[model samples]
Target: MRKQLINPPQIYDGSPFGMSQAVIDRASATVYISGQVDWDANRQVSCHNVAGQLKKALANLTTVLEASGSSEESLLSLRVYVRGELGEFIGDIAPILAQYLGESRPSLTGIGVSSLAYPEILVEIEATAALK
Candidate 1:
């Protein structure tokens, strides 16, 4: 798995992500996942809050990763989109992420967006995972 930093130097230096000092180095065989929502396999909208949706979304991401023979530990980056304030949303999902990812949290980016794919949905997470 590749090592990704929370805040790469290039991101800070006015450069694109392709060139980043925070990226100590990188490995290959990355798996890209699209934005995951709160829907279940039955196509039912599960949770109303960010935490519940996040859990389901993470589970969805895990399914995608596993299908490609990868695990959560192989995550190189996680980009999270929230419909509101960071503190309000993250307060619910952070602990779940801590438990799911264990020690390696992976590089994270959280943004406050106007809305999500669904009106009730508050959080969506997209990931890039590298295989060892």
Candidate 2:
């Protein structure tokens, strides 16, 4: 199955932020990944800062996506929850997410929350992907 991105000239580009305005997936199964934080198997938030935590969270999310027979290209959307403003890190994080997501740019929503599940956790990312 293929995921189709819909973005006409009337709308602005969203790829820089690792998102698209509209995404249509044709996979038979849909995978809902829980909010993935920087916590390891030991249930510890080893990453102390947003930059570090964001990297780990993305990696964790990627593992789940792959395990589900889905890839970043099969992703439908990502809801990002950050402890603080997401603007400052967009320049840094967007590129990394783009690299991870490759050519397929899925829809995304970013929200700034007061805190996450743990004190040391600065960001949590949840994803929805399509699987065959």
Task: Give the per-residue Cα lDDT of candidate 1 at 11.
Answer: 16
Where model 2 places Cα greater than 4 Å from the true spot, the runs are: 1-28
Q: What clash count goes with each model?
A: 0, 0
lDDT of 1 by residue, 9-127 (tens): 21123133243212223455566666766766444677787788788878776766665556789888898898888877676767888898897779999888988866888878888
Q: Per-residue lDDT tens digits of candidate 2, residues 1-132?
A: 476554333233446657543444555466766677786655577667777888888877766665566777888888888888888678767777777778788998888888876677888888888774
lDDT of each: 0.68, 0.71
Index of the highest-lDDT prediction: 2
